[model samples]
Target: MHVPDWLDAARQRELLEACRRWARPPAGLRTVRTPGGGTMTARQVCLGWHWYPYAYARTVADGDGAPVKPFPAWLGELGRRAVTDALGPEAAREAAYDIALINFYDADARMGLHRDADEKSAAPVVSLSLGDTCVFRFGNTETRTRPWTDVELRSGDLFVFGGPSRFAYHGVPRVHAGTAPGDELGLTGRLNVTLRVSGLPGPAPGGGRSGPRA
Candidate 1:
């Protein structure tokens, strides 16, 4: 579990721009209320298919009603590059990182401690943070007890967890207001995108995850 401080500003800007485009409604971004009665905006660009914003499985129809944003292959490559850079190119090839869950955090946003256990793949989750700073709470998989680590995450920081760290309970306790890069960055709020590969039975195709099994 290591946080890379070498992610230069230019790279950060590149990812930020990509997120802004992905955050566009229809193309990917959509707002929904959380189980706790809070709200969260999600951008599902890739990772094959997913029932984003919703925790259930359903078929998503595409029509004039709601435009669906196709997942960009380039972003998949970007995720690969991130893994290769952090865990070496060879390891990156073996890593499964296809779906990215871009979450927008408001001033009052907070994520309770939980494990990313939905996906069957054991590959590490590559999380990128842009705009604003927040305290990340990392806990163990066995229990939400002691041995928890709270770390500060700022813009352009990359957090990767694999091997023994995968399946660990982690979340954002809070997001500091007015911490984003501003208008120039095209990002007005905090953006956290987590790239993952969903290892469903068959090869998952593009389109909304709310659809019948192919």
Candidate 2:
């Protein structure tokens, strides 16, 4: 479901600013290379759990190998509120959003049809969009082909999918360049922040465990 203008101007500004900081150095924004040799046009950064082509890790094993930035509590709270607004209070109260994947899309960037199956949890995925609008295709789990809905997601839009739709196939087919929110937001391309639960064991205090390989 799409909740248009779910985030007010002030909230949008705040998140955008936070994203700028999160996109810098160490565990910062970087291109994602698929195992197949092609690279994703959109650059991304992960929090809580680092994401590679097909799995999640505690560190960016594919990048600088630094530990990922911790997921902010404030962002988790915001996600809970979003779940309550989009799903219900029960889901909001139960959501344990510990991971965030922030994808940056330029004009020519597009995500292929895919399902977010790396997460072990069955919880819903909450996506918050900022900057330019894009055609977000929501498809079925069985295949990447037809019977999908193309939703035009603009800045401040919130989309939450759970239940049967939780594992559905989805992707961004196109982004309308130069359509970012006014300069006051300080965002150029599109920024997509998706919050999820890792469902994996948490690291012991002082880092007692290593993430399993893919």
Candidate 3:
């Protein structure tokens, strides 16, 4: 429930710049209505010294297991700091989160209610918002039925869900247009990078996970 505005403009710029450099639009970057009745477009760009997913020597844009955004280690560390600041270092045990799916949302883009269950690890997922804003819908674990919470997600804000809320059903129902940083940054869309440690056993091998792949 803690949203940190601690990431200053400079830090935010640093994150956005790094993300752009490693941007890789997934094969499905085009507009499509998801099962949850919302439209969305996204690209998966890998980050770090290695390209990711593949984890080969050179970081290439095309390959398996490639990261969507290679945010600097320092930035990830900052996310841990935010977690620690909010929930303490004990909760920051997994500071070295390595995979993220950078989701780009246009004006009409929307995401249906779902859960982040791809990763084997139940560690917290740190989501950073850049450009634009939308209604982030969160629901309970039982089913996508009634009883839910609507939280507005803005630029430069962070949302971490672990512990009891880790497997909570969540999604984006609406995205306001022209809410992201423009061409000056060489980007004109809403970017959301969610960092996590993946490749673990969950509900099932390829079952009900609700996040994009590496």
Candidate 4:
């Protein structure tokens, strides 16, 4: 489901500012390297659970090995509202979401076709967009090739995929450069924040990592 302009301008600006803070330190934004030995152009940072090739961890085991950041309470609240809005009150009632994967995209950054299959939870994945617009390629569960839909995702848009489409393949194939109201938001790129339920056993590492910038 795609809910256009779900965040409004004020919320977009606020989330962008929060992204800046999360992009620093030991567990800060870093490039993702796939198991096949290729690096993703879009840099990413995670809260509650750090993700690697195809697994989740409490530390940036693929980058700095620092303890992952905490899943902020405010984010949890926001996610609840999002899920409630997307899947109704009943679905949101039992949702205890605790993982967020935030990605920062430059003009040239593009995510290839892929599927989000690391989570054990069947709950929906809530996605929020900020900054520049992009062509989101939402594909099928059977393959990365065609029979897919290309949706233009702009700033403040909310996209939720779950139920039958929960494990479907999806990606950002192109980010229209400079399309963002950069002068107003002070961001020249794109930011995609996805809230998910990890459903992993054990709590995240109780420690935090802070120090020199990444």
Q: How do all models score by TM-score?
A: 0.78, 0.93, 0.71, 0.93
Across 31-59, the per-residue lDDT of candidate 2 in tens digits comes to: 99999999999899998899998998888
Which ranges in model 4 have alpha carbons more than 4 Å from their true place? Answer: 205-214
- Candidate 4: count the clashes: 0
What tens-digit string does per-residue lDDT give for candidate 4 at 1-214?
Answer: 8888888777787888878888998899999998899999999999999988899998899999998988776776677788788778877776677898999999999998888888889888899999999999998989998889999999989898877898889999899999997677788889999998888998654423232121
- Pairs that collide in candidate 4 are none
Q: Who wins the lDDT comparison?
A: 2
Write the residue-wise lDDT of candidate 3 on 1-214 in tens digits: 5485645566667767756644535322223333466543444443432222223222333444233333345555666776776667898886566555667776766677777775557778788888787788878887887688888777777788778988989888888777655643344667787776654332111212221221
- Per-residue lDDT value at 61 in model 1: 36
Relative to the true structure, how large is the alpha-carbon lDDT of every model? Answer: 0.65, 0.87, 0.61, 0.86
RMSD of each: 6.0, 5.5, 8.1, 4.2
Model 4: lDDT equals 0.86
> Which residue pairs in candidate 1 have backbone atoms (N, alpha carbon, C) closer than 3 angstroms, thus clashing?
47-99, 58-210, 58-211, 59-210, 59-211, 60-210, 60-211, 132-179
Better of 3 and 4 by TM-score: 4
Question: Candidate 2 at residue 39, lDDT?
Answer: 98
Q: Which window of 10 residues has the lowest lDDT sum in candidate 4?
A: 205-214
Report the C-alpha displacement of residue 120, candidate 1, in angstroms: 1.7
Highest-scoring model, TM-score = 2
93-199: candidate 1 lDDT, tens digit per residue: 76645566777787877777878877778877888888888888999989877689998888877787777888999988888777766664555557787877666
